[model samples]
Target: MAALAWLLIPLFAAIGAGLWGSWANRNRKTAGDGIELAGYTRFREAMEKPDAVVEPEPHSGG
Candidate 1:
């Protein structure tokens, strides 16, 4: 019974630590803020600039 209790103490501690870490990071924001708006702005700018070639297909056939 003593050996079983010793083993379970560390197992429970590890489970508690994992739960705490996940809860701590729940509200964090990533680096891609305003990404959609920025992409649209760049696309519009590329269309307006005459020197830039807005190719119909940017990717070549593999």
Candidate 2:
């Protein structure tokens, strides 16, 4: 019936979404602790560098 067909629309959508998500994430793996620690170390080293000094321009009186 038309009513049954409409009722199954969401069920089919949910099944399709689940299958797609599984396929999409099937090969994904995290870089884990070593990569994360390296990133933090690089960030700390960059922050310890001194900032550049800038000289102000002299004002000209009209």
Candidate 3:
């Protein structure tokens, strides 16, 4: 009985892992690009714009 219980531990663990994996991989976005990809593309476009510029402020020493 003790040996059986020990063996069952791995069986349960495997079952739980399989269930979690399936749940995680369940499909959703079959259409256009995903949100992260779209956001990254927009960010890239904004960064590439010439009008967008950054100016640094001068620091004063005490």
lDDT: which candidate is best?
2
How well is each residue in 1-62 modelled by candidate 3, as lDDT tens digits? 99999999999999999999999999976766687799999999998888856787877866
| Reference-based lDDT, residue 58, model 3 | 78
lDDT of 2 by residue, 1-62 (tens): 99999989999999999999999989868778998899999999889888766888887866
- The C-alpha lDDT values of all candidates are 0.89, 0.91, 0.91
- Give the Cα error of residue 40 in candidate 2, in Å: 20
| lDDT of candidate 1 over 1-62, digit per residue (tens) | 99999999999999999999999979877777599889999999988887865658676678
TM-score of each: 0.43, 0.42, 0.46
* Poorly placed runs, candidate 1 (over 4 Å): 28-62
Output the lDDT of residue 22, model 2: 97
Judge candidate 2 at residue 50 and give its lDDT.
88
Better of 1 and 3 by TM-score: 3
Model 2 pairs in collision: none
